[model samples]
Target chain A: MNYPIIVDVTLREGIADPEGATIERALPALGFNGISHVRAGKSFRMNIDAEDESSALAIAAALAQRLLSNPVIENATARSAAKG
Target chain B: MTRIGVVVFPGSNCEYDALGAVSALGAEAEFVWHSATHLDGFDGVILPGGFAHGDYLRPGALARFSPVMEAVAEFARAGGAVLGICNGFQVLTEAGLLPGALQKNRGLTFLCQPTTLTVESTASVLTRDAFRGQELVIPINHFSGSYTCDDETWASLVAHDQIVLRYKENPNGSRDDIAGVSNVEGNVVGLMPHPERAMSTLLGSADGRVLLESFVGAPVGAR
Candidate 1:
């Protein structure tokens, strides 16, 4: 079976997001209003050959933890992109 | 003479500078390629600055997997002193030899300038000879140099005197003005400043001598 996975890596809550803050600060000048919060993160999309959805998720979860994100500061979530 | 080994990753640009600095300190210095599996006979190891693995997937991320890192980690565990500067500091954190991680500069710009650093702790191998609260002028050149960590880690670091140096002016907006830190055992030290580049008065400052000399002069029985 084939499963399409997307791994989203985000800085943990309470960690400062300077880049996101800078972008949000710039938004008001560009006529975009009411933007209260903005955060930036990285996403990895890939397909894996697996026995089942759970297996692919497991593999992706491991990769996300080991390579895609630094667990000390970032949290990563791996989920299937395929529709049921 | 103290024999110091400088680890060279494929993209490391400061290995030669580190060699010169160690040699100038009257210590025997040599380059250790990244693929070597063992770090035998060296009294100390240095991870010099540069964009290892082209700083891909974030600085120091890819370089931690190098074969030499395993040996470096082992050397540090065995009590050999290790100093990581700039990108080397990034590698240390990525390799889990040191705490926290380097993030993009607060303004999202690559900063290149002389920075003032204050010696916060003299307990670490790199700062053993330095005096607490003494200030040193060093150079910092990098895009990702902001130091960040969780509140829990920060509290422990404070309790342990692990924060070795701090930026007097907080150039990159690192958390708590942290410019350098050491491992729990104080054998491994990492900092974003380029101390090697500040080795001579002709270079505008010779304050690095205190730090580099401290590394070279560490107790022989410690390693």
Candidate 2:
């Protein structure tokens, strides 16, 4: 079976996110009020060939932990892609 | 004669600089392609700075899996000296040869300037020639040079005396002003500063020679 997966990577909480902070700082100046806690991250979408959806998701999560994110500084999550 | 291998990733721009600097210091330096699987007859290895794999995913993320890294890891395990500078430092952390991570600078700006560093530990191959508390001025050029680690790792690093150099003024908001660190055995080291660029006073400062000399002077597999 072909399982579509989406991986989201983000800086782990408590780590400094300068890019996010910079964007948040600009929001109030651009007349967009009350916007806060902006964080920047990366996303990867791929299809996995596996026997079942659970297996595919497991493979994707393992990939995310090994390559898609640096466990020291980033957190990654893999989920089944929503069908269009 | 000491033979040092400088690993060159596809996007590496500082291999020549490392080669020239080490050669000027009287060591035989050569470039090792990232695809090569072995590092035979090398006393030490230097990973020069550059946007490895074009900094995709992260500065050193992709380059960590290069073929040469396996050999580099094996060499390091056998007590050979390994030094990583700038982007190379990022690779070391990703390869798990060193601790901590290099994140985007605190202000989100690329820093290119001479930074004063205090020698914090002379136990590593890179700093053995320098005295404790000695100051050296080296140039740093990177966008993600700020060093960070979790509290547990920080405590372990402190306990092991692995922290090698510290910035005098906290240039990039690195945790505890750290500029360099070494593995527990002191054979592997990683630093964000470019000591290769400071080989001559004519260019700026010759303080970098103190560090490079220590590296070149060490015996093969000195740990």
Candidate 3:
């Protein structure tokens, strides 16, 4: 199955988001109500074909290590979904 | 027979390009892991680009204490020619081989874009074969490249022609548009761009060759 998976690397929960802080300052009267905390992150979407979910997850992990992201500031995971 | 060494830390990503550029110009480049202690005799050293140690604390902050940097600091003190590219530049500063700190870009973004740089001083070892004020197009990929220095340091850099490369348009909010700088002795040089990445038009423009070629193009002792 060919499906797209995304990896988002932003600050974890309870972490201060400077980027979010800047955006929140402008959101009060701009029609974005009830939006409290906002953070930014890198997104990666790719298609992979694997015999099983484990193999697909393994591939994702390897890609993340090799080039998909910088492991220092970024945390990542492997998520797979079957296409209809 | 000019032997060059490319220092490789745990997270360095541009050693391959540095080796390629050196080998393409008919020199031998050996990879020196950051864990090593001593830098054996070599013609020159190129601290090629990459996010060394992941820039965890600060760009080059932790990398300064790496074992191999001791040798690099000694080599520069002895007047060996060294050039740091991008993160390599940060490491050099952290190691105290050069001065100043590279802070987060004022724009607060991971800027990866093609940039323009002007050759500020042709008299330095890295640009002695070229004409000053020559502008070249190259690529810059960095998050914390804003160069910060005190009033005295900035004045000295300007007075001694220590700046060899200045950005044509100040891409990183660096002080005085400093794309690259050299030491007072002209033996150590560092810049915040990837010259090796732009050595060929196939990768992109070959304008960077003008700078990288300077390392191997001339005699060892002359500036």
- For lDDT, the strongest prediction is 2
Best of the candidates, DockQ: 2
- Model 1 CAPRI quality: medium
Q: DockQ score of candidate 1?
A: 0.78
Q: Which tens-of-lDDT digit does each residue in B19-106 have in candidate 2?
A: 9999999999999999999999999999999999999999999999999999999999999999999999999999999999999999
**What is the TM-score of each predicted model, taking all chains together?**
0.97, 0.98, 0.73
Model 1: per-residue Cα lDDT over B1-223, one tens digit each: 7999999998999999999998999999999999999989999999999999999888999999999999998998889989999999999999999989999899888999999999999999899889999999999999999999988899999999999999999888899999999998888999999989999998799999999999988753352
After superposition, which runs of candidate 1 have C-alpha atoms over 4 Å from their true positions? B220-223
Q: Point out the worst 10-residue segment of candidate 1 chain A by lDDT.
A: A11-20
Give per-residue CA lDDT, model 3, range B4-95, as digits (tens).
88999999998998899888887778999999887777888888888888887568877878888889888887777788989998888877
TM-score of chain B taken alone, candidate 2: 0.99
Q: How close is candidate 3 to the true structure, as a TM-score?
A: 0.73
Stretches of candidate 2 exceeding 4 Å from the true structure: none
- On TM-score, who's better, 1 or 2? 2
List the candidate numbers ranked by lDDT, top first: 2, 1, 3
Greater DockQ among 1 and 2 belongs to: 2
> In candidate 3, residue B54 scores what lDDT?
89
Chain B vs. true chain B: TM-score for each candidate? Answer: 0.98, 0.99, 0.96
